[model samples]
Target: MGNTESVVVQKRLTRFRPEERPVIEGVFDRLQGGAGGPSGAPGKTPAGKTLTLEMLQSSMGSLAPDSMVRRIYQCMCRIDPGMAAPAASGKTSTPTASGVGREQLVIFLADTMRGTAEERAPLVLAMSQHGAGAAAVVTCEQVAEFLQDLISAVVQILVHRGRLQAWKPEKMGDGSLGVKLLAEQMCSELKPSDQGACDVSCLEDWIFRVSQVSLYLEMLVAEGLNVSLSSRLAPTLLPPCRETPWKELRCLLDLPVLMFLAPQLPDSYNAPWRLVFSTQLHGESFTRVVTGLTNCGPTLLLIKDTKGHVFGGFASHAWEVKPQFQGDSRCFLFTVFPRLRVYTATGYNQHFMYLNHSQQTMPNGLGMGGQHGYFGLWLDSEFGRGHSRARPKCTTYGSPQLSGEEDFTLDSMEVWAVGKPPEPEEGEEGQGKRSVLHMDPEVQAIMEMTGKTLHSQGFREPEEDQE
Candidate 1:
């Protein structure tokens, strides 16, 4: 920034009173629900003059130049919550419901003003360059719109260097989608979020929304759950629905990455990441609710055992109950509450973890092991819970495995799907490749007794590649 501009920014920064300074680590700490603080008090930082540039950088978890800018942006939002374009003069619409209080500001910081320094610099510059006398009401959207126009050249750099190409299904061959994105379109595909129940009236409200989303993602990573967020790291897409289960466990929604799915979805397709999906539904009613769940895509399945312990799997594909096997490698079992432990696909011991119907015969149910089966976990067609037993196959996950020999019955089943399910246009690529092909266990047993190979209709082994 020029000398005049720097002086202007400093003056604006000092506008807020010392009493308003945060006592703790800014808004992020508060969102953590006081996870770490003196006396476990809510994260309200003390009002102080220490929010200088150096202090801001030190507070940043990421040291990138852009990350530093983001830190400054956070400080500005907190210290100058009043800085903004004014609410409209006409109809007094209610503020966005979710954005009504503190949480709204957090989301604005995390989403709208996020990305690299180049992405957020214009907003900072706009605020700094504005003459103090004018003090125009600067909405976050207005700043964003201004940046798009002024930085068209920067965006053009991407156009000259990159071009769109059709995506094919495969395991991420090391993040080689062969392209670099323009700044403007980086998060372009995520659906334009519903402005909650109402529209944001002023600037500070936008900042809070950004702040909230940023804190949530950072917390997710700090807790050690895997999430793909960086532009360079993380595959564009995991193996398709057939080859693998989950699309990709991305922490933040990125348009370039999401558009790689087969059926191209809308720019406003992002929603699942904004909220917590902890609702419970029953097995009997599950099928009915499954389609609607496509909006909140893949989900977590929790089964409460008769012993009062809860265990379940992550359904990599959307919940669709057909008379056959669906889903892929992304599906894995997990346990929440009494300590979190996730058991991923061993690839080797996959015979039992897959979903199937006709092959089992008798009662159409999930397949555990072939012919010599081990009913490690089972949920009946009824809405009630099923059974879980200890299993040798799940040993790699440590401790006593899920299923037991005594046929432990479960008490309840709860499911949670995140985001909207991939659209039919977005393409499920490898899912839904099989259907009811298993005969009754009795008839199959008799056929096996008479020396018959149990092959589901249309089941064919692929030919080996010729050298």
Candidate 2:
């Protein structure tokens, strides 16, 4: 009997450490008959089972609701000494209805945002149950703005670190480098006049100038021209003949060419650059005059009608020629537009310019004296809207609610660049590609479970977590 008693004492000692004694004693004090006589003292209990009663009370309080409920059966073994079966295998009763305040909702949302995916799920679920779910409150516009700010911050960080690619002198030439550097510096120095919304209009102009400079540099690089010398000699290349009729006409037709060649023209009329002209007599005895010159190579002149019908040929030799045409006497205009395709090897850009005598009275008309004539020379890629897609809309919330309505809630917003899709397999069969839109299955499951638990706790979804 002594040996058996010793074993029992050892087991009881192993069940709880000395530090846990106060907690056990506290639970017993709360459960026993309030501080009064026989009913309160442990020693006066019937069958001398006060120790067992105290253990049971402590055990129930210690069992975490998050853990599997079945474990409570094992805990009861030490608490209820004479019990043959375990307590009910289920969750505790839900909390009573008590409305959470707005400040409390916000705090809850902040906490949820900091929590793990598992911890957050229940909070989201509770919010949904309370009708103050994410969908009912948060707005898509707010989400978009948040995303934009996030992206801008990330881009700024990357640019500061110098991880982004810069213009390569060897590949883009000295002229290109100078232009790009100037643009970058200008952008860095310019401060927005207003702190309203993000305005990218100023950046558009900078982009156009950069494109022009880059194209010019690329052309020189293709011809193996030394940019340093070319830049120095730019002003001296053009002659005083800039006032000449033909020169003016060419400038009107191609504005970009004029801007690009302006710095390279010579002060005097050395006429180092060749000039050529050709006129063809058509079937109606009308003269189709073509006048242009190029320092690079042979220029291909193509004249097309309103119906996209071509009628011109390449001028290999400078000689007067005649052509035949069956069309009526229609006003034919010479115009140019940038080629849709890019030629990196030749550094030849497809640019367009147009002249329409018929639309002389239109709001945007063409003339020799007006600014419209130099269209091609001033044509820039940056002046218009850049490439971008429309973003989807989202909802917003001003406060948290307790009505069952939405699927989820968000506390903080994050934006990420779209990455390249994975390459397709060469030989795999019956395999499907993954989509960027959907969340992972494991994440969904965890969120679902979290929501259920939070709902049971009678907590409404937090407000700050709404998108």
Candidate 3:
């Protein structure tokens, strides 16, 4: 770095507020004393004091594993070479021996939370490849392993520290699988070299393109260190969740998946996620599913195929069981199991959402994207039978087949009503109520088995005789 860049890096020392400065300095001082040091000791001199890997790990609590803390300590050393304590005569200095200085810690936190993409890219590379040279190249498998550790650490912090906002992990699907899937998705974004190795240049490109990489790193540091750097960290990374029925709510998505997908939804980051339907909680009845979906506002539909392929779509509007297509361009198809990816509309066609039942001429199934019989995702009204037929790709969403096979057997499904419901008309508050009467009789039968109540019907008013 040039002299100008060096000055900018040094200026990050003042990144914390006056009040928070003491907190940061206190952390530095505590860690500098090394493990087993006196807790009430006065602040140490920043110039000579250094923090070893053991010191860093001890200060990080149990949220992050030792390996993760090692990477972070290496990152601190790499951020400023001077931070690494010089090797004594006849002694080889290892990463643990090259302790982190106060200046390095300050710049690391500042660059992670508030620095430009250019400033954080190198730090990310260092964190991912500990003890490697600045120009070291990494393979996909190496990057994936690092991501897995990072994700695991973040999930532990969220669950152990009660940061899930009342979300119950017991009611959700396997979080370990979620961690592995999310790591693969994050690794897929890396631009590897011709030899499939990710050098510093590729890492920089990735950090520039995927903003979440920086976001995750910031969260890992802030939460793992138990530091209060609110002035620098962006709170909007995970917006405030609204109230919901905690006991009744169950979901296939874990907190990490939820955190990744929540920000992707358009203008719904602050909205509540209501459990509209779930095949596990509610029996396999297409009619009951449709009834639960009506007038619930924008929703997320998730399906787990028998082959363990988990995928779904985001409905930009409330679902209505009609022959014609519904939903706006904001609608998208996504995969959750094999990997996490969202395919938006390509504008080649308008076959965004399709939900029809009981019409002989039209298809008696629910579908999204593509056209007619060749929908990107289809769920037959008969239940358990579905298909993801995308010939090269769905013209609407540009997504390929999402299920394990072209046709698949549904193992489970979930529908979450995201955000607040759209305001109803003055006299149409119970509009979706009547639509329930028109639902298939089979749905009514299975609704009992699935525990779905027909209580909405009791509130309907008798229609007066028309003129």
Number of clashing pairs per prediction, in order? 51, 43, 1
Tens digits of lDDT, candidate 3, 106-187: 6777777666776776666666674534435668887787788788887777777667765777877788888788888888
Q: What is the C-alpha lDDT of each candidate?
A: 0.34, 0.23, 0.74
Better of 1 and 2 by TM-score: 1
Q: State which candidate, 2 or 3, has the greater TM-score.
A: 3
TM-score of 1: 0.31
lDDT tens per residue, model 2, 182-280: 333323332333542212233223323434322322222212111122122222211222112232222111222222332322222132222222222
Per-model C-alpha RMSD:
20.9, 34.1, 6.5
Clashes counted in candidate 2 amount to 43
Question: Lowest lDDT 10-mer window, candidate 1?
Answer: 91-100
**Best TM-score goes to which candidate?**
3
- Candidates arranged by TM-score, highest first: 3, 1, 2
TM-score of 3: 0.83
Stretches of candidate 3 exceeding 4 Å from the true structure: 1-9, 14-26, 37-48, 81-93, 130-135, 230-250, 429-467
